[model samples]
Target: MKLYIAEKPSLGRAIAAALPKPHRNCKTHIELGNGDVVSWCIGHILAQADPEDYDATLKKWRMESLPIVPEQWQLKPISRTRSQLTVLRKLVKQADEIIHAGDPDREGQLLVDEVIDYFNISKKKKSTIKRLLISDLNLPAVQRALKSLKPNSDFMPLSISALARSRADWLYGINLTRAYTLQGQKTGYNSVLSVGRVQTPLLGLVVRREQEIAKFNSKAFYQVQAHLSLQVNEAVSFTAKWQPSDNCQPYCDEEGRVLVRALAENVVKRIDNQPATVSKLESNEKQQAAPLPFNLSQLQISAAKQFSMNAKLVLDVCQTLYERHKLITYPRSDCRYLPKEQLKQARGIVNTLAKSSLPCNKPAQGANTSLVSKAWNDKKITAHHAIIPTEKSPENISLNTFEKNIYLMIVRQYLVQFYPAYIYQQTKISLLIAGGNFVSQAKIEKQQGWQVLFPKSKKTQAADEQEQTLPPLTKGQILHCQQGELLEKHTSPPQSFTDATLLAAMTGISRYVSDPAIKKVLKDTDGLGTDATRAGIIDLLFKRGFLQRHGKAITATEVGIALINALPEMATLPDMTAQWEATLTAISEKNASYLSFMQPLTKTVTEMVYSASQQSFAGLPKVAFKPKRGKGNFKKKTAKKPAKKSG
Candidate 1:
């Protein structure tokens, strides 16, 4: 029998649906009429063995066992998943050939590969294996993928990269965590100082941003505003902001901010009654195309901004849309561009959505299919395309509010591709007053095009440019200045990280780095973590008590802040992730070996152990988990009166 193993039951069922009539034999396994069996894993059936599994002495936390590097790695099936493991082991023993139908990523490759290797080791027999790399779980895509299954050995490099990453994380995380936790314990602080390759740097980002916000000092600045009435239309009035010249040293800055009180007052007095003339008036037509489709990070950011949702919730909702309802394409994608070949299917999807009623708080709008934008370029597509609705409609399916909201987001992104580009006319007006240049700008909506689809958040002149209509005027035209006033404003510090901004920071972290090489590598690679794993990484941080959420903003906890500060600079910096990503990429490309990557990581782990052992933790903030007590058994020490010390 040909056995098929998938990443999860949903995908396994989808695969079976694509094959001939499949009979459900058990909840965890299925049988096809053509002598084939299908099975799945919830996630990872096996995990790397912990240190205690290797040696009983290693079970206890001790400084002597600081850097635990196993001579040979081991794996054990997770207790909760042992039943499924048993089913897979039995299937492997009876099958003549095996098919791996995991997701199309490194982690997915490793998931099925590990299961196969474990069963092979147990049954003492090697089965012929083939890989089914399916991007979409829909029947057509699955059928196409089945016809082009590649030899499982062809993906050994991906498996190697995944294994290298796992071992590296274990080696560094175990050793560094023990070293730092022991150091904190020596200082009378009893807490686990958890550290991770990706989590620590993410925590460092939050801590550093908080530090900057805390230390920032606000400075007062002054601006002069004038309300000018046009002579052409007496009823038409507009506002212009004053721009100071470069010669106004010590009194004003290049941004036209008057720093000195006297200087600001003088400028206000000089320009109050001065005659103003229109120096320049320029109007140009502009066009803005529809935004690209939703990548996982982009979708998370948008959902967070629009509905105050968290990253993990958004992923879960999108997963439901993909796995349960089959309403959208794959959600764990990072690419924002769709393949050109998919344009044919995209048209069908648009037609399907046009006939369905998309639920919203208000009335629903129909989808327009007049034009398809450049988002369908094949050259830009990566392993998977953007998240869009499948060529199926959700007409009769019942959905909760959360699911409806997310489904609408995906649907809108797809419908936008068929709408015309947003068009507008931009106007820039410059005025001369008291030998200083004042500028005003406005935008006129020439065509509502794409904005029609997004009426609630439509872009208008006031919303986008913050300028009202300016009456018809020509150069050298005079205008009446109603009044000039000094506006006192203070600079504001950076806002805390909301899910929207934090997701942006994670995907664009390389922008903050000063090193060109590392930045380039990070730019080429997806930032910090892949779309499939970033949410889990963030969820882990919250579970570990390293981060807390206020409203929609995330802040590092005291323990989290302290942990980042205690770790070495190398561990907290994002360059470590970038470097590892580069090495992992090379290994997958067959340019580097797993040993080559692991050797350096092992050396670094050893060095970190030694360095952390020498570092002292004196004077570090000590937070007690228990209530504070007075000197002796809840009694305070009496203050001794100074005894006649005057002499």
Candidate 2:
């Protein structure tokens, strides 16, 4: 019998549909369709043996067995899916040959490789093993993949990388969780002080941001604006470029302060509706390259930015779209582009999407061949090109609000790449008003390009309702000052971290570090977490009650903030994780040793544990909150408290 191993049951059924058979109706069992047998793993079918699995006494949850590093690891069927394992073992045991049809990536490779290891399939010499690779799950794609297969040995290196990641997460998660939970118990808290390499750093970010929020001191600042005649440059001029006596050194970060101190009555310049001279008009016409296709992280970021959905929520929606609807590609990928060959079918998928709530217009002309040189490298691609719509139009796939939002995002991003570069004329015109240099700029949209299909990009900053930019104008051209005012404002502190920005920070957090040279080196490296796990990392924070979302805003909980404050200075910072990712990526690419990269990190974690435990976190320290009354809040309580009711 020919046996096929699929990553999940739904996927297994999809594969089974394409196979020649008596059409074995897939249930929760491995069954034969005369010529073949198929069974699938929902998730990790087998997990590494816990300390308790190694020694029965360890099951009691005592702290004595500090570092439970097993010399030889053991695997046991995950409790929830033991039945699937039973069916799988029976099939693999009886089969004459087997096909490994796991997803074609590190995690998928690990999932199947470990399943085989758990069953000790190698010990049984009769089953000839060959692996199947499928990039998309449509029937034709599945049939094509079924005809050709490679030896499982070809995926050994990726499997090794996945194993390393899993083991490292286990080692770190197990040890640190126990260490902290035990410590939390000692500290009079009944809750487990949960921690992980990814979780801790993630929680630390929210907590620290909250702390910054708590510590922020509001100060009055202003910008000196001169309301001039319909002269465009003069009406919008800011005082920063105007030097006092042309000899005074400018403020480091106090340009706003200087403006605030200046009297509003001070009229720096006054002019009538004079013909403004065209001093310097520079226009640059550049094509906006199409956005790269949807990688998991990019999808999450865009969804969060556009629809206010969480990363995990986006992933869940995409997963449903990918697996259930079978209308899209894989949901867990980190690339956002399709292959050269996929371009033909991509247009068809875009056309099929005409039935959606947010349908695609006709595929843009030259979208296929106009891929910017920087985005067309085949080497950057691996198992998949990017997330895109499949040629198949799904039927009756009902999606919830979140799912619909994510689906829209994927469809939009995929379709946009084929649209023409957003050709525009960018003009920057400078004007020398009376005594100071003033600048004015505008974007003339010569062509809407692919942007015509995109909904307006959402933002949390001031509601810039103006979606269009003006055409070219001479520096001296006088435009009507329909509305002009010296808007008194404060020097606003940096906005608190949102999940989208937080993910970006984790990817290239070295930018926040103080050391110039090291920061630059770190800048060149990929961020702390991979696209696959970044959402999960954030979810872990929420699961542990380390982070909370208030409406669209993210804040750290008390336990999370305490963890941040209690850490030994290094681990709590963003740059540390950036460095860690840089090193890990090097290790993954074979440019560095994991042991060498992690030595210092291990020491840092150790030091943090000791320091956190030793600290006299005697009382739940009162968290100080400084709330600013936003020129509002104070209102007349017209209705009294019902005259104290019954008093």
Candidate 3:
């Protein structure tokens, strides 16, 4: 008997529907008409045992019990999901062959692999295990993947990498969190002070940004503007910014701000009503290609920017579209490009979506498929292709506003791939007045192209006010300066991070690092977390009370700031964690042994334990928070009230 095990029940149903002879019914396990059984795991049925599970005495937090590393790792079935485990064990015992139908990623590989290992331990003989890799849950995709099952041993490397990561996280998070929480107790701070490999560095980013903003002192500056009228055309008047003299270097900064008010006033007076001659004229036509399709991170960033939706909300919406409706491909992918061979499939998707009543009008109207985009390349494909709408039409499906918005975004990005590029003309004019040079720039849109589908808002239009149409003009033409004003402005501090900017920072953090080698390592490796887990990491920080969200902006709380200050740099810097990710990648590729990675991890934990022992929390501020444990287990000492003197 052939048994199929999927990652989730929804995927199991999809697979069962696609199998030959159809499925009679799907309940605990789908019994197909062809005598095959299909089942699924809700998620992980087994997890690595907690530290306390290793030894009952380790339940109480203690400094001496630091560096807790399990010698022989054990897996225990989750109490709430044990019934599913029982069902899976019963089916695995009767099966002659098993197909591992999980997501094509490291975590997915581990989720199903762990279950097989758990059930096969008691059996006298192991069933043949095979892997089914598919990008989407569509009927055709599922059938194709079923026909091309590979040996489960082919994915052992990825499963090993996932296992190593899980163990390492256990070693670092469980041990260090206990050590730090105990240290916080020394200062009367009654919080858990939770820490992780990625969570701490993410919090450090927010805390450092807040510190910089708090310490910033706004400085006043001034600039001169010339509102000039062209001699050739009366309707072609424009504003040109004044350039400071070379001798007035103190007034000019890198941002072109004139700090000295008196110098700026003198320049305004000197250039007032001055006759300016156009010394240089330059014009060039520029073309901008359509935006690439949505990766998980890019979708999160765009949703945050456009609709003020947070990262977690965006992921939830996309997941529904992918898993529930089956209207889109995988939502957890990191690649933003399609396979070159998928161009034909994309054309069919565009045609089917054009007839659907989706929220985005562009896909419904039609896409120009005469030209292909550079985004269709084979080498750019990673674990999965970009997030995109499937060939399925959503005409009869009911969708909420959030689902509609995200689905439209995916559809529009796909439709734009077939449209022509946006074309515009850039005009740059240089003016000579006094002893300095002034410049004016403008952009004229020649064709809306793919941008007709996504229109710019009023705020974006106002931001591009400088990009106005210019009349034809020749060089050396004298223009009349109508008026001049010295505008005073203060340098603004960096804005507090919003979900939009924070997501970008997490993905592109290598730009901020100073060390070249570490920066390259971080770039080559996925930043802080994978596209699939970054949102969860951010959510974890909020749930732990390490971060507070005010409107769209995120800030580190006092406890969070204190936690970073308390931990060593090696524990909080992203580069160090990124290096660990690089090592894990090497392990996955079989280029490095697991021992090489674990040895350094052991040394790092030992050093952190020593560091926690020597930390002095004398001046640390008391933060009001309770550790997430049983209330009566550990109590903060309360000072006794002073005795009355008049008694």
Candidate 4:
């Protein structure tokens, strides 16, 4: 009997549907006509064993057991999924051959591989194991994957990389959390002071930004504008900003903003009613291709900005769209480029979109299938492709408001791949008036092209109002400066972190690092965390009372600030995540050894635990403890006595 073990039930059903007919669906396994059976795991049937599971002495959090290092790691079946795991164990023993079906990523590869390892089958049976990788649940995509099975041994490195990440996080998170929680107890703070490999650094980002905003000092600056007109046609006029020369450096700030009002006033007086000659003029036409399709991070940022939805909510919605509705491809992919072969399905997907009643249907109908964008490149493809709409028609499907909106967004982005590039002309003119230089620039939209698919919002329309349209002119042409105006402005402080900006910061964390070498590594990696885990990390911080939100702005609380101040600089910075990610990538590529990564990590953890022990968490604020309610804690409510005489 051939046994297929899938990552989840929905995927198991997808695989079952593609096999020979006469399917018999049981509670946990599906039986096909040809003596083939399919079973599944509920997410991950096994989890990493806790520190206490290794030894009874480690059960209690103590200062002596500062860094709890497990000599040999172990896996325990998660209680909730124990039944599903039991079914798989029995099936593995009975099967002649096993096909490992998991999501095509590092975590997914480890999820099933660990399960097979738990069975401890014969070496010969292990050698015969096959692997099935599926990124899309659509019928055609699933059928295509069925024909391209590969040996499971080929992905052992990926599984090892994931295992290293798991053990590293466990070693880092468990030991540090216990060490810090005990320290907080010393300060009379009666709560668990949690720290993570990724969450602490993320919280540090917020606290640092808040401090920067508080310390900012607004400064006043002045500018001079020349209202000029064509010499022949005085009716046609435009405003040009004055550019200060090197001689004016003493009166200007480092950014060249005029610090002294007198300097701006002098420029105004000198240029008023002067003959301004155009010293240089340049025009260039440019074309911009449509942006690539949504990766998980990009989609989360967009949803946060457009709908005021949090990162967790966006991920949940994407999962439903991918799994339940089967309307889109995998939602956890980090890659934004599609496989070149997927281009063949463009016409069918576009046609499906046109038949639907979506807001983007009209634009989808007009897509030119013959025009291919740069988004389709086989070289750029990673473990999985970009998140895109499936060819399945949604005309008869029932979708909620959030689902419909997210689906439309994905569809519109995919349709744009077939649209023409946005074309525009950029014009710049440099003028000399009374020994001072002035400049004017404008962007004229020559063709809306792909931009026509996205309607501008009110904020975008307001920005468009500032765009200027310069008249045709030649170099050395004379113009008259009707008058000069002096304007004063104040430099504003940096804005607080919002959901959108926070996600963007996490995605592009390289911008915040000071070390050049680490910054380059982070740029090449997937920022602070994987696309599948970033939302969960952010959500975890809020649950721990380290972060709070006021309206749309996110801020660190007093406890959060104190925690950051107490921790070591290495614990609160993003530099460590960069280094780990680089090494993890090498491990997957077989260029680095797992022992090399883990030994140093273990040494680092030991050092940090010792360092934390010596430091006093004196200023840490006391967290209010909320007792968990149990059956015995419940109190029945009594009916209030009638007070009817209140006339």
Q: What is the C-alpha RMSD of each candidate to the true structure, in Å?
A: 8.2, 9.3, 6.1, 6.7
lDDT of 3 by residue, 1-647 (tens): 88899998988888898886656774678998889899989888888887677898777777898778878888999898898889999988888788998887778888998999886544434435888877777887677678878887778887887787887787778777777768777887765666787788888889988999999999998878877887533543778887766767766788767788888788778877778889999999999999999999999999998899989999999889988898899898878988875676766677788776665544556687667898888877644688988878888999999999889888888888877899999999988877668888888889988898787989888877745566677898888776677889999999999999988988877865556788876663356667888899898777656788889889997767888888776677777677777777677677777888888988898888889888776545674553244232223432221111000
TM-score, candidate number 1: 0.85
TM-score of each: 0.85, 0.80, 0.87, 0.92
Pairs that clash in candidate 1: none
lDDT of each: 0.77, 0.63, 0.79, 0.85
Instruction: Mark the 10 consecutive residues where model 2 has the least summed lDDT.
Output: 638-647
Residue 130, candidate 3: Cα error in Å is: 3.8
Error in Å for residue 299 of model 1: 1.4
Residue 588 of candidate 1: its Cα lDDT?
70
- lDDT per residue (tens digit) for residues 1-647 in model 2: 88888998878888888876677565764465576778888888887777677888765544566555666767778899888888888887877887888887778888987887777766444245788877778997788777778877766656666665666666666665656555555655444455566667667667767777778887764443423333444444321122232332253134524443443323242322223334677889968766777788878777878787788888888888888777778878866555565654654675567654444434433245344324445667655567777767644677678876677677677767666778987866655444434455566668877777665546712334543344446555644332223446666666777878777666556766555665776753377577778887887666555676677778887657876665555555556656666666556556667566545755665555565556544443233221123331222221111111000
lDDT tens digits, residue span 204-308, model 1: 888888989999998898888887886533543888888777777657655556788777777778777567899999999999999999989999989989888
Pairs that collide in candidate 2 are: 276-476, 277-476, 293-336, 294-336, 337-385, 337-386, 367-418, 507-527
Candidate 4 lDDT for residue 501: 91
Models ranked on lDDT: 4, 3, 1, 2
Q: What's the distance in Å from true for residue 126, model 1?
A: 9.5
What value does the lDDT take at residue 218 in candidate 1? 87
